[model samples]
Target: MNAESPNIGAPQRPVIRQLSEDAANRIAAGEVVERPASAVKELVENALDAGAQRVDVTYADGGKTLIRVADDGCGMTAADLPLALSRHATSKIDGSDLLNIHSFGFRGEALPSLGAVGRLVISSRAEGFEGAQIAVTGGAIAAVRPAALNRGTVVELRDLFHATPARLKFLRTDRAEAQAIADVMRRLAMAAPYVSFTLRDVSGGEAREIFRTDAEQGELFGALAGRLARVLGRDFADNALPIDAEREGLHLTGFAALPTYSRGAAIEQFLFVNTRPVRDKLLIGALRAAYMDVLSRDRHPAAVLYLACAPELVDVNVHPAKAEVRFRDPALARGLIVSALRHALAGAGHRASTTVAGETLGAMRPEGPRVYQMDRPSGGAIRSAYAWQAPIFAEAPAPFAAAPEPAPEAVNYPLGAARAQLHENWIVAQTADGMVIVDQHAAHERLVYERLKRQMAESGVAAQALLIPEIVELSPADAAR
Candidate 1:
């Protein structure tokens, strides 16, 4: 037994081994650099951390061929260029404090992660210093050298994931990836209205500017509305209600749309913490709850909310990509959003959006001459030519009529008194200023839907078993609230 199998009971040698720097960085890149949009996010965040006032992004072939991000921030010198490419070399924070993170690119993982999977070239120039450049390819470091540049930094990455073809295979179509990149740019632009941003497409032989925003730093929310109008469209501004509310040291400020202006999807909702864009579950749920009463169940309200609080109140290092966040007091943040949004909406009143109002006016103008009717109470009133005389008969005492009912004060009411039901469904209501045309069918449908929802909420939904047993599966980890 000893000669043939080398003794089965013999202890095996330790198989543990340390990974090379390249392999370690590549592994980290898989998490940090998921796609081209991720690369754009990390690089732009680094630029912003450098105090860049203007950032420019150019991409080709959906960033699979080439991607460039240039910023006019304080750049690095020849001595610092090489260190900037080194792993864990960060200027944002020291090793002491993890909770106090003001800048976006705190962890030194993004740069190395990018260099590990792509051909990266960083050219930078510090103030009153010579310009320099450094290159990294597939995690292989190159020597720092002098480069031709006046000021700031420009980072270019070509042939992303070329060394790792499998990563390239997982990328989406060029159009989809390009749209994702645009979304990232727009979100960042909205967050930093003071800083200018430009995006270019250099795919079809020549470079063309896709989107651009100039630096317009002013008072808080200054030019923010203009920027939002440009990004979300002019109609959004016409329909949006300004929100400025604070509670429990958390200040919330942004634009929330009217309930009637709700969209078919929740894509327009944007949430930020201390000017940092995020998509957290607590924030999203609170937004939904705020619009629960005003908006229909099938529709979604659009808004862009920014919250400013102490850095310690929020943990931005929840993930390597830094897209999600963990609030120290999650309940405080949720309550702040719900309270702020509801207050803003209440102040906005029960009015429709500009688009809806215009459409209603246009539709009514095409109809025939407007007909007027007598205002009568709905006390078992029948639709007859003697409809006007029935009210007098109801108040009669003996042979003559008793005291007639006092007329209602129409000025205090919103829709005034209902006059008649024209065309069977349309209710002609007289107002102090003008008459309001209400579609009874549509109004009744919404009322019924809301009533059903209230009943379900109070009693809970009843479940009925199917004739055949059904199968369902759930993940081990709990879903977001």
Candidate 2:
């Protein structure tokens, strides 16, 4: 040891311990559920997975203030209530099985995350047992207690992000949050048409009948169409065309609008896989390819398409939110959408009518008119007519009265002429420098959606002008959020 400076040991380092259950839950929640809408999504999925026939969601102050989701699903027993809020405790999946996920949620993170961040109260009752309630606030759990409730689950969340005030600043206005909540409800409702869904805005006193479907419906399409009519308005149902086709073990089914009914944006394209709503690029590309020939570059079509196949063919776990997916065979999925919609449209007998001078013309006629006639000149025919015509009309004799020439026919310029049908379904068009392989269905869908959006924006949405307005019923707690 030097006398000038006493021998000193290395600086002491603090040992790190594994996060506690409550801390771990808050961390997990940061990834799975962010805002109130995320909480709503997880709860709604849980309800659906629990075999709920009807679900009701209510919100206030853009979900920053409050959110509640009640489901008439298989209610939880008293024993299950405590386990429901425990981290990593989920009825959806087993820890051994991470590869195959059939349900919308399986991480077992939602309940814990929600409880960690907000004032969470979960009340439920199975058929045999009395109702039980559990409350958790800021990662602190209160003991479970007996409660009175119907045979269902009601989850109430209040003061979202109160424990984490930093997240509170990220929320939007109440109206915007309400709109986002409505959008989520619409997507979920579209996915599960057989389930009744109701959404209420407690802050504004605005109640929307989001969805109502009879479980006895023969097939999903009918119920889905009814639900879409409720969310997207009845005009969409009338304008949409049915789509059903199969390729490479994948089945595509849904409805797409005609090119004439396009919208100004791609917002109307509702895509689902195995009854789970998603926004896959391949599917959107395929839809675009379907209407490439009939629509302009600026427009999009309106469509609601469902794809079904083996779960292994598509990976739904690509995102935490699961709004997007990855396909084992991207080309095959794109091809299926393009071919299905193209074939369906063709079979429906919808031919693009020619437009000229603001008027739609019927199909072309080979012998309709002779704009230029070619004939062998008779004896003195050409010379004599030309020789006499110039002298008689020296100053053009006041322009000749002739019908205006018909406007040029609009031609289908294959995007790049690199038009190759991939997988016997998709039409790949080459661009000027880059290649633009389109999904015929998604392209047409974009076009149709664009036109409709433009028309709506200019003249306001064409409401059905209801003879008798449909009245919506709501629950008291739901009404109060």
On lDDT, the leading prediction is 1
Q: What is the TM-score of each candidate against the true structure?
A: 0.76, 0.70
Query: What are the Cα lDDT values of the candidates?
Result: 0.82, 0.76
What is model 2's C-alpha RMSD? Answer: 13.7
TM-score of 2: 0.70
Q: How many residue pairs clash in each candidate at the backbone level?
A: 0, 37
| Model 2 lDDT-worst window of ten | 356-365
Q: Which 10 consecutive positions of candidate 1 have the poorest summed lDDT?
A: 472-481
Task: Provide C-alpha RMSD values for all models, in order.
Answer: 14.3, 13.7
Clashing pairs in 1: none
Question: Residue 107 in model 2: shift from native, Å?
Answer: 0.9
lDDT (10s digit) by residue, model 2, range 1-481:
4465433667567898987887787777788877778888999999999889989888877788789999988899878977888877888778675657788887677888998989999999888889999999998989989999888899999998888888877877776777677778878877887888878767667655433444436676777677766667665676678787888899988888767667799978989998888878888888999889878989998899999988779888777778888889998998889888888777755432111201211111123454544556676877656765775636544334568999987544545453454532345665556676655445554556776899888996666767888874442223335
